[model samples]
Target: WLAKITLVENQVLLKYFVISASLAGIIFLKGAEGRICKTFSAISRLSNY
Candidate 1:
Protein backbone atom coordinates (compact mmCIF):
# COMPACT_ATOMS: atom_id res chain seq x y z
CA TRP A 1 0.00 0.00 0.00
CA LEU A 2 2.76 2.43 0.86
CA ALA A 3 4.62 1.72 -2.34
CA LYS A 4 1.48 2.15 -4.37
CA ILE A 5 0.77 5.51 -2.79
CA THR A 6 4.32 6.66 -3.43
CA LEU A 7 4.07 5.65 -7.07
CA VAL A 8 0.89 7.62 -7.53
CA GLU A 9 2.46 10.61 -5.88
CA ASN A 10 5.48 10.34 -8.12
CA GLN A 11 3.29 10.21 -11.18
CA VAL A 12 1.44 13.28 -10.08
CA LEU A 13 4.67 15.11 -9.36
CA LEU A 14 6.11 14.19 -12.74
CA LYS A 15 2.98 15.37 -14.51
CA TYR A 16 3.04 18.57 -12.53
CA PHE A 17 6.65 19.19 -13.43
CA VAL A 18 6.00 18.60 -17.10
CA ILE A 19 3.12 21.03 -17.10
CA SER A 20 5.31 23.62 -15.46
CA ALA A 21 8.02 23.11 -18.04
CA SER A 22 5.34 23.60 -20.68
CA LEU A 23 5.12 27.23 -19.63
CA ALA A 24 8.22 28.08 -21.58
CA GLY A 25 6.78 26.55 -24.72
CA ILE A 26 3.50 28.29 -24.19
CA ILE A 27 5.26 31.61 -23.85
CA PHE A 28 7.03 31.05 -27.13
CA LEU A 29 3.89 29.94 -28.94
CA LYS A 30 1.58 32.44 -30.61
CA GLY A 31 -1.56 32.37 -28.47
CA ALA A 32 -2.16 29.23 -26.45
CA GLU A 33 -1.53 30.72 -23.01
CA GLY A 34 -5.17 30.64 -22.00
CA ARG A 35 -5.68 27.01 -22.84
CA ILE A 36 -2.39 25.97 -21.34
CA CYS A 37 -3.01 27.76 -18.09
CA LYS A 38 -6.50 26.31 -17.91
CA THR A 39 -5.19 22.80 -18.30
CA PHE A 40 -2.40 23.41 -15.85
CA SER A 41 -4.76 24.69 -13.19
CA ALA A 42 -7.13 21.82 -13.73
CA ILE A 43 -4.38 19.28 -13.38
CA SER A 44 -3.03 21.01 -10.28
CA ARG A 45 -6.43 20.89 -8.68
CA LEU A 46 -6.75 17.24 -9.48
CA SER A 47 -3.35 16.52 -7.99
CA ASN A 48 -4.24 18.39 -4.83
CA TYR A 49 -7.46 16.45 -4.48
Candidate 2:
Protein backbone atom coordinates (compact mmCIF):
# COMPACT_ATOMS: atom_id res chain seq x y z
CA TRP A 1 0.00 0.00 0.00
CA LEU A 2 2.86 2.38 0.60
CA ALA A 3 3.98 1.91 -2.95
CA LYS A 4 0.51 2.62 -4.20
CA ILE A 5 0.24 5.74 -2.13
CA THR A 6 3.61 6.90 -3.35
CA LEU A 7 2.52 6.40 -6.92
CA VAL A 8 -0.60 8.43 -6.37
CA GLU A 9 1.36 11.22 -4.75
CA ASN A 10 3.78 11.26 -7.62
CA GLN A 11 0.92 11.51 -10.08
CA VAL A 12 -0.54 14.45 -8.23
CA LEU A 13 2.80 16.21 -8.15
CA LEU A 14 3.33 15.63 -11.84
CA LYS A 15 -0.11 16.99 -12.64
CA TYR A 16 0.51 20.17 -10.70
CA PHE A 17 3.93 20.58 -12.28
CA VAL A 18 2.39 20.29 -15.72
CA ILE A 19 -0.27 22.82 -14.86
CA SER A 20 2.30 25.24 -13.50
CA ALA A 21 4.46 24.86 -16.57
CA SER A 22 1.50 25.53 -18.83
CA LEU A 23 0.50 28.59 -16.88
CA ALA A 24 4.08 29.85 -17.01
CA GLY A 25 4.17 29.37 -20.74
CA ILE A 26 0.97 31.32 -21.15
CA ILE A 27 2.25 34.09 -18.90
CA PHE A 28 5.50 34.25 -20.86
CA LEU A 29 3.69 34.32 -24.19
CA LYS A 30 1.46 37.05 -22.83
CA GLY A 31 4.66 38.99 -22.04
CA ALA A 32 4.04 39.05 -18.25
CA GLU A 33 3.74 42.81 -18.62
CA GLY A 34 -0.04 42.83 -18.50
CA ARG A 35 -2.19 43.75 -15.51
CA ILE A 36 -3.49 40.22 -15.09
CA CYS A 37 0.02 38.80 -15.04
CA LYS A 38 1.02 41.34 -12.42
CA THR A 39 -1.94 40.36 -10.30
CA PHE A 40 -1.08 36.69 -10.60
CA SER A 41 2.52 37.39 -9.68
CA ALA A 42 1.40 39.34 -6.65
CA ILE A 43 -0.87 36.53 -5.54
CA SER A 44 1.88 33.97 -5.99
CA ARG A 45 4.23 36.15 -3.95
CA LEU A 46 1.71 36.35 -1.15
CA SER A 47 1.18 32.64 -1.25
CA ASN A 48 4.91 32.13 -0.89
CA TYR A 49 4.84 33.68 2.54
Candidate 3:
Protein backbone atom coordinates (compact mmCIF):
# COMPACT_ATOMS: atom_id res chain seq x y z
CA TRP A 1 0.00 0.00 0.00
CA LEU A 2 2.76 2.41 0.84
CA ALA A 3 4.53 1.59 -2.40
CA LYS A 4 1.36 2.27 -4.32
CA ILE A 5 1.06 5.67 -2.67
CA THR A 6 4.63 6.49 -3.61
CA LEU A 7 4.03 5.51 -7.16
CA VAL A 8 1.01 7.75 -7.39
CA GLU A 9 2.94 10.64 -5.89
CA ASN A 10 5.69 10.17 -8.39
CA GLN A 11 3.24 10.28 -11.25
CA VAL A 12 1.68 13.49 -9.97
CA LEU A 13 5.07 15.07 -9.54
CA LEU A 14 6.08 14.05 -13.03
CA LYS A 15 2.91 15.58 -14.46
CA TYR A 16 3.54 18.88 -12.68
CA PHE A 17 7.13 18.96 -13.81
CA VAL A 18 6.15 18.33 -17.40
CA ILE A 19 3.55 21.09 -17.31
CA SER A 20 5.92 23.64 -15.81
CA ALA A 21 8.66 22.75 -18.25
CA SER A 22 6.36 23.17 -21.22
CA LEU A 23 5.14 26.52 -19.91
CA ALA A 24 8.69 27.71 -19.50
CA GLY A 25 9.55 26.54 -23.01
CA ILE A 26 6.58 28.41 -24.48
CA ILE A 27 7.53 31.61 -22.68
CA PHE A 28 11.12 31.32 -23.82
CA LEU A 29 10.04 30.78 -27.40
CA LYS A 30 7.75 33.80 -27.32
CA GLY A 31 10.49 35.98 -25.88
CA ALA A 32 12.91 34.88 -28.56
CA GLU A 33 10.33 35.58 -31.28
CA GLY A 34 9.75 39.09 -29.95
CA ARG A 35 13.44 39.78 -29.88
CA ILE A 36 13.83 38.59 -33.44
CA CYS A 37 10.94 40.78 -34.60
CA LYS A 38 12.39 43.81 -32.88
CA THR A 39 15.78 43.18 -34.40
CA PHE A 40 14.26 42.79 -37.82
CA SER A 41 12.37 46.04 -37.51
CA ALA A 42 15.51 47.84 -36.41
CA ILE A 43 17.38 46.55 -39.39
CA SER A 44 14.59 47.56 -41.70
CA ARG A 45 14.61 51.09 -40.31
CA LEU A 46 18.37 51.33 -40.71
CA SER A 47 18.14 50.18 -44.27
CA ASN A 48 15.44 52.67 -45.01
CA TYR A 49 17.56 55.49 -43.58
Candidate 4:
Protein backbone atom coordinates (compact mmCIF):
# COMPACT_ATOMS: atom_id res chain seq x y z
CA TRP A 1 0.00 0.00 0.00
CA LEU A 2 1.04 3.56 -0.53
CA ALA A 3 0.83 4.30 3.17
CA LYS A 4 3.25 1.50 3.99
CA ILE A 5 5.75 2.78 1.45
CA THR A 6 5.55 6.27 2.87
CA LEU A 7 6.18 5.00 6.37
CA VAL A 8 9.25 3.09 5.23
CA GLU A 9 10.65 6.13 3.52
CA ASN A 10 10.16 8.23 6.58
CA GLN A 11 11.95 5.70 8.76
CA VAL A 12 14.93 5.60 6.43
CA LEU A 13 15.16 9.38 6.38
CA LEU A 14 15.05 9.54 10.17
CA LYS A 15 17.86 7.02 10.46
CA TYR A 16 20.06 8.98 8.08
CA PHE A 17 19.45 12.17 9.99
CA VAL A 18 20.37 10.54 13.30
CA ILE A 19 23.59 9.14 11.85
CA SER A 20 24.66 12.48 10.41
CA ALA A 21 23.98 14.30 13.66
CA SER A 22 25.97 11.79 15.70
CA LEU A 23 28.92 12.05 13.32
CA ALA A 24 28.88 15.82 13.53
CA GLY A 25 28.80 15.65 17.33
CA ILE A 26 31.78 13.32 17.42
CA ILE A 27 33.78 15.58 15.12
CA PHE A 28 33.02 18.61 17.22
CA LEU A 29 34.06 16.82 20.40
CA LYS A 30 37.35 15.73 18.87
CA GLY A 31 38.08 19.24 17.68
CA ALA A 32 37.39 20.63 21.14
CA GLU A 33 39.69 18.04 22.72
CA GLY A 34 42.50 18.90 20.31
CA ARG A 35 42.16 22.60 21.08
CA ILE A 36 42.26 21.94 24.83
CA CYS A 37 45.40 19.83 24.45
CA LYS A 38 47.14 22.51 22.44
CA THR A 39 46.19 25.16 24.96
CA PHE A 40 47.51 23.10 27.84
CA SER A 41 50.80 22.50 26.11
CA ALA A 42 51.25 26.16 25.41
CA ILE A 43 50.53 27.09 28.99
CA SER A 44 53.05 24.59 30.27
CA ARG A 45 55.75 25.88 27.93
CA LEU A 46 55.06 29.42 28.97
CA SER A 47 55.30 28.50 32.61
CA ASN A 48 58.69 26.92 32.01
CA TYR A 49 59.98 30.05 30.33
Model 4, 1-49: lDDT tens per residue?
7566787799998999999999999999999999999999999999999
lDDT of 2 at 25: 97
lDDT by residue (tens digit), candidate 1, 1-49: 6666787798999999999889867777746777789989999999999
Which lDDT values do the candidates have, in the order given?
Answer: 0.84, 0.88, 0.94, 0.94
Q: Against the correct fold, how does model 2 do in TM-score?
A: 0.53
Q: Which is the better candidate, 3 or 4, if ranked by TM-score?
A: 3
Candidate that beats the other on TM-score, 2 or 3, i.e. the better one: 3
Clashes of 2: 0
Report the C-alpha lDDT of model 3 over 1-49, residue by residue, as the tens digit: 7666787798999999999999999999999999999999999999999
Off by over 4 Å in 1: 1-5, 29-49
Q: Spell out the clash pairs found in candidate 4.
A: none
Which run of 10 residues does model 3 get worst, by summed lDDT?
Answer: 1-10
What RMSD, rounded to one decimal, does every model reach? 15.9, 11.6, 3.8, 4.2
Which is better, 1 or 2, measured by lDDT?
Answer: 2
The list of candidate 3 runs beyond 4 A from truth reads 1-5, 40-49
